[model samples]
Target: MTPAVTPAARPRQVRRTLPTEEARDLLELVRELIHKEIVPVADEEEAAARFPREVFRRLSGTGLLSLPYPQEYGGGGQPYQVYLQMLEELAAARLTVGLGVSVHTLACHALAGYGTAGQRAAHLPAMLGGGTLGAYCLSEPASGSDAAALRTRAVRDGDDWVLTGTKAWITHGGIADFYTVFARTGAPGPRGITAFLVPGDAPGLTAAAPERKMGLGGSPTAQVHLDGVRVPDARRIGAEGEGFAIALAALDSGRLGIAACAVGLAQAALDTALWFTAQRHQFGRPVLDFQGLRFMLADMATQIEAGRALYLAAARLRDTGEPFSRQAAMAKLFCTDTAMRVTTDAVQLMGGYGCTSDFPAERYMREAKVLQIVEGTNQIQRMVIARDLAGPPGR
Candidate 1:
């Protein structure tokens, strides 16, 4: 029951509706950058497991790294919707860059949304646009989904807080110039937590060897160990016990970023399938000419469009200052699930070739698996949605 539309002859040229000509121009610039700087080297860099620090620097220099933030702080002053669409474009080219940007944005969220005016004025310009990468440190070796249970501790000293613990599965872990760390300052659990902006090179702060991830190998994921790493009270984000609330608020926005990335990855997989099918001969004609394969591609495109719409709709809610936590959860859940399905189908459409490393289908499929797990798992998203719908389980 879906209408068929002609696919773009080239990927990353999908049609869009933007709020302003500025947004349209920004997207075009992103596509150009992705085509020139990201896509060509993506497979090779990922294969070599090389972290593209230079790519991030380029993104930062162009102001793409801080699009969703305010222009006064050296950002592009774009809306959430515009920023997310740009994420989609980057993700279609390479997940490392796209998700890396998302993680960096997540790292900045606490400071941007909850920091004192002095903190923002002092740090936002550099953090947003001064060619520095950032990591978010919420997860630990034990506490991932249950973030509030984090064991990292921050003890008050005369003029500083000494932090000690291990933060696990941190993107840009070893390479980031800064870290947004959540540490326990009082009793256990969420309310006892506090957020700190810790310099990456602070004394006794170190990163473990990068994890051997299933995909996005070009981006580093490592455990950051903080042993008596001292941070000034001036660096604390929000009140003494407001870190968990700040973190939750940040995640609400972060989920939408993940959703956009998922949609873009799906679009990439679908594009790959489209190109391969149209060229591969089956019997006397192209595989895409077959009814079954055609239908499969149709479904893939349909799913991609639906996912895009879902994320964009949630982003619009955020742009308009609405409570979008539930919508964010739904978009994250549906778009990531769609990415998994579409990437799997892309591989299926390519037959044995899809399973091989020579093509991108297998890689996209692998990357899709991670999306469902990050920014809170799909299971968590479902829980969030259910709680919004029927109140908490006890109620």
Candidate 2:
């Protein structure tokens, strides 16, 4: 029987190990590239509300895009812990790029976990190699957090299945080369959902005009419209009614990705604030010289460190093949909340400068809010944790 551990003991039980030398070196390289490449053009892209496809291609060239899948399938095969760190580093540079990576990872998870041998053979290589980008289609206009209420329909007709629906808030709606779509296949609710791998060029598939967003402007978010898009039976990811389980499991891992992004954004905000505080004069000395301001900086650093610890702990649990769903939810909850706090404090430290695009702090603050909402809202995360603590739902 498994030993029972209290909530207080769980952190010690799920602590992370130090990263390998190779992982450290790769992360350092990623940071350097982000500073030199991504940061320089972030403002321009943000102002234009354009998705940087070329930049994604450049990232793909770095082999950073395929870090967590198997080498046999053209992936780098790095552990989830390492992959998440890379995500954190990327997000610290620019949230749009980080979100793009997370969406791609979700798409990869569906193919990796549920794809048939033939499907994997046909698609995994291109996806891992960056020749093909992917998107996840689960949410509809009517189905936000209640994904089970999705109105998308997939009807089996002989050898093909025709799909018709509108998938909203897709991260790479117009740009991805493929999409992992979930559609109604059974009764009503999650048990009826089915997963399919649809090529981007599939007939009758198009993207609606992109949504106007508060942030992540450089990443295009739009609705995907499927009008009788037909896919072969071979394209089905898993058995009918398995899509909900697959999507939830993939999200358990994806929440770790979002947590990493939050940590990175917090770190960026803190780093920017620290640099500015040291340079900006106040009362004939630097702002950092003030004890009151210094204390706030200390708090920001502490929270960011705690957030990192939580997400890394969850990632390690996942990498080790342990039961990490609860841990992942906890990390997502804590890290995103911590990020919101830290970024807000960072903005406060900057006074008027924080509210403008003259610096990135304002953008960081905006991005942090969205992180809390995505991959399941913080309220939903609390319910998940409470349910886990209460044991099984009907017990």
RMSD of each: 3.7, 8.3
lDDT of 1 by residue, 21-138 (tens): 9999898889888878887788878889888899889999989999999898888999999999999888888898889999999999999999988999999999999999899999
Residue clash pairs of candidate 1: none
Whole-model lDDT, model 2 = 0.85
- The estimated TM-scores of all candidates read 0.97, 0.93
* Prediction 1 TM-score vs. true: 0.97
Q: List the lowest-lDDT window of 10 residues for candidate 1.
A: 1-10
User: What lDDT does the true structure give each of the candidates?
Assistant: 0.91, 0.85
lDDT of 2 by residue, 6-32 (tens): 111000111225368777777777867
Q: After superposition, how far is residue 5 of candidate 1 from its true place, in Å?
A: 28
Error of 1 at 199 (Å): 0.7
What's model 1's lDDT at 106?
Answer: 98
